[model samples]
Target: MKDFQPQNEEVKAIRVLLHGPVGAGKSSFINSVNSVLQMRMTNEALASSTTSDQSFTIKYQTYKIKKEGKENIYPFVFNDVMGLEEKTGVKEEDIKLALKGHVKDGYKFNPVSSLSDGDHGYNSSPSISDRVHVLVCIYDANASEMKEPVLQKMKKIREAASELEKLYYPS
Candidate 1:
């Protein structure tokens, strides 16, 4: 396995996707992270708005973080994708578009579009790696019956990423 290191001083931004099951409080978590960091989301590029039943539909939210003393702005992109098990209205394409940026009908999402080559149509670009740095996979800590579903989803995510790495960069 490759030893992972923190980004260099020149590398200013980081892409993160907050994926998990429904009602696992992904959106709430995002709000809390911003609250702690003293930042607010300004540019909402994805489906952040939804009704009560299917509110968490968007794959993710791209946020621009401006750290103190940093010359370049850090892109704190967080993808709040649908639950893996019960995907009601969510589409795989939406997931692809959220992380790597997408381009459709003259509209351009550079990040999503860059990730269109992977098995799940994600970015395979080295410069802009489309893998989740920190996948905040949430599960109901209290629920008993439904706990397994959430856990299974998290396992699938890990397995998928691991399998992908093994396929592309096998030892």
Candidate 2:
């Protein structure tokens, strides 16, 4: 995997990461946002893995939401990844991949077996010129508790985002 680095400090990309545990309202939230905004969806959600599974979002998808009564278009990309399980071991790679671009035509991704050990799918780095935006972490309202693991995951995500921001915008 390439070292985590930023390429530019001028271009800002409106990148929003939607993460949550399994059965969270991530997919539904994306759909609802799309519907309410009446934005033209430029891309569809992809399977997170090659294997046929109910929960895996195979591909990272992008959607374009036009501003309300404006000529400008806002591009929103939402990636639905596999949930955080004890043995899946694909967190880091999945996170990096989500930050990367979507799957190419006929290109296949390697399934991750270790959380931190996997290929960084895209070479794209964060850019300050690209408006790197928000990360919305969804949660199941019915979950039993926000235990240790859950809290840890949230912390890591925030840390990663902060680091990225620093890299992209050194102010």
On lDDT, the leading prediction is 2
State each model's C-alpha RMSD to the native. Answer: 7.1, 8.0
lDDT of 1 by residue, 23-142 (tens): 556666656655555456533333344424343444334454444554444355455555444434333344434433331212222222233454443434434344444445665576
Off by over 4 Å in 1: 1-5, 8-12, 39-53, 72-76, 84-127, 147-153, 167-171
Q: Which ten residues in a row have the lowest lDDT in candidate 1?
A: 103-112
Those runs of model 2 whose alpha carbons end farther than 4 Å from true positions after fitting are 1-13, 39-54, 66-73, 100-120, 124-132
> Model 2 scores what on Cα lDDT?
0.49
Error of 1 at 155 (Å): 2.9
Q: Per-residue error at 109 for model 1, in Å?
A: 14
Give the CA lDDT, 0 to 100, for residue 116 in model 1: 47
